[model samples]
Target: MTDPTGVTITERHEQDGIVMEILEWSRLGGMTDPAGLPLLALMRTAELPVRQLRLTLTDAAVVLEAGALQAWHGRIEVENTIPAGRLLRRMVGSALSGERLFRPRYSGTGVVLTEPLLQCLLPVGLQDETVIVDQGLFLACSGGIEVGAAVQRTGSALLFGGEGLVQTRLSGTGFAVLQSPVPDSELIKVTLKKGETMAVDGPFAVLRSGSVRFSVGKSAKTWFGTAVSGEGLMQILEGPGDVWLSPLQPVYDGFAALARTLGPDATEAAESGRRR
Candidate 1:
């Protein structure tokens, strides 16, 4: 598909990187709950080098476009029982925007854009020897990563294994895009309070928020294993894959569930109902 500017947008997924043009058809008020509102609808109308993007929807669309530091296009997939709303909230958090910039999250798979964003207040990168900790599961990536902190191990293997949390103090100013066990955009940034510990899935799960003191801890109970704590901002995300939002899976499953519950002709019915 092509946009009014003649930019051809197509859907695809590759191990490398892809560029495309995206046209958002709606705006979401800064509402945490993403239900009872219209879905964020768009078609792959065009593909371009995507030198720069402009979000025309209401609220802070333009801010998001400008604030976005990096953008990459690719395919994504998810298969889990997580709620769609929770997953989408995590993606919006990934963009470091409180506004509703994405739709509900779901399981399945598809293509989408993956981005790494930072808060305007923090430095562009982590300080030398600064440790970034992962409190949930270990993520494996082939990309070379600057070691921020020395690696450490805990007594309980489950609490510190690849399925648990990993911690590393920062050594210098740089960023590491560690792979996630789940496809999501939310990167939680939190400060650790004295004696405070946070258990979460990964560092990418909490993209960019204010900093506090934090450390990795174990599950409070059986199911509720790890979580992040402290008085600062902490991000949470959900979707497909291990890292980044699996566009195909989340978007496809979200809409599919909506369609099934509302009926196959829901989108059309929505238009008709709006007209009435």
Candidate 2:
């Protein structure tokens, strides 16, 4: 939908290397509620080309993944939350892997902006809850919560498979926001009862935490058995918790499918490089 101005504020534009959309509406008109509360909500501006996700905060705090603030207005307080001597080790692990250990805490009475890639925001509700997130995926969460330590797995297959070594975990009683690759409509939430087990052949898992046991192991006991199983390395999740997965498979799936679509020329070139 167009902006309320009848002019062109909601339109998307590319400046320098960044793509941006200027939003305008009644909410953006400095309108406040009866108690003087800001109308905070996530607004979807356009469906394609430039899909937008807007979040407004009313007198709250958000822990942003460091350096993610795009723009903001009104009463905003920004501060760097440095870890003390007790938590230095855990914080250092995240910093080594391209993620900021000590992220900036955003709290105030105004609105904050984010995004250069136009990704959708996934708000995760936490009640002493914990979410193990891929590095750099941490967006913003309520001030009541805390960003916990990093998670690591030393499996040889997991590293070479591109899952990486470090992931951030947020835990507390509030809502944590994450930058979602798939939109909320496309995210599939699967609830597994206690003692139940499920395995995914791909890294489709977005978030898996809370009483769930997660590991990367062989698809089968034997090499020949794995071949018959038609699965190589697998992400195993044992529950009593929720798992969010994407239908698009994983990151590699996109490249593989695109290569197939571009036909034999692309496939042959990739195969030739692999041989070399």
Candidate 3:
């Protein structure tokens, strides 16, 4: 799966008239300093793959997240297909669901590429089914799919579930690409039977099928019981469908926060305080 441009196709997915290739760079360039060489070697040893998506389309159309298009080739036409009548409604839905108001649609035959991202790209297929995903997870989808907003079923879920009042809902028969915080290997998929329940303490549930119901409830019968159990409110999902959970997302978030705190600006401030 190696390409002439030093990019390797780590994964490939083909479904519903689209071919997607997950490209990863074997080695990064542009570093000239000897000191940076050690850091680069360390990054290679750590296996931190920088990935991107390459899509091949033939007489088909796809909708991409705003600003996701990096480049394209062949005969392709791009347009914002927002109808004037639904402009106001789309705007409000975008605000509540945290999705961009305008998603560019690319139609015709072409090879499309998206900007390189550190996050993992997950491709999901649907056959007359629907799935609800957390906001900001959507990257691209086939034109046959319908993208809309889904509101929280209850007030407690909206307030305590950690996901906002609305989430992104995708329906119809096609494929969708989602930007996941963690790699697919780390994701835990749970299929629940009818009336089965799953509870989580954090916003670790990234996605759930449309048949599932999301809510929030106390971990124990009372506040005192919850405190004693060391668990408080939990996000609850009642289902007869699939749910994808990323239990390691919180660890990644903690590391990112620590990196920000120890960034160059903080280092410079510390040096100034020491000098003073």
Q: What is the TM-score of each candidate against the true structure?
A: 0.27, 0.69, 0.88
Candidate 1 minimal-lDDT segment of 10 residues: 54-63
Per-residue accuracy of model 2 over 141-163 as CA lDDT, tens digit each: 76777886555555653463345
Assess each prediction's global lDDT (C-alpha) against the native: 0.31, 0.63, 0.85
How far off is residue 130 in model 2, in Å?
1.3
Q: How many angstroms is residue 258 displaced in model 2 relative to the true structure, after the best TM-score fit?
A: 2.8
Q: What tens-digit string does per-residue lDDT give for candidate 1 at 1-276?
A: 124543333221122121222322222234465453333321111111222221111111111121232332223222222257666654554354232232222111222232321111111233332334443221211111232222224344334334233343223333323323333333333444444444443333322222333334444433233333221222222221122222243454576699899863686676566557
RMSD of each: 17.1, 12.2, 4.9
Candidate 3 clashing pairs, residues 3+ apart or interchain: none
lDDT of 1 at 253: 52
Off by over 4 Å in 2: 1-58, 154-162, 227-230, 250-276
Candidate 1, residue 72: lDDT:
23
Runs in model 1 with CA error above 4 Å? 1-124, 133-152, 155-171, 175-189, 197-276
Error of 2 at 201 (Å): 1.1
**Model 1, total clashes:** 60
Candidate with maximal lDDT: 3
lDDT of 3 by residue, 5-44 (tens): 8688888877756788889886788689975665465456
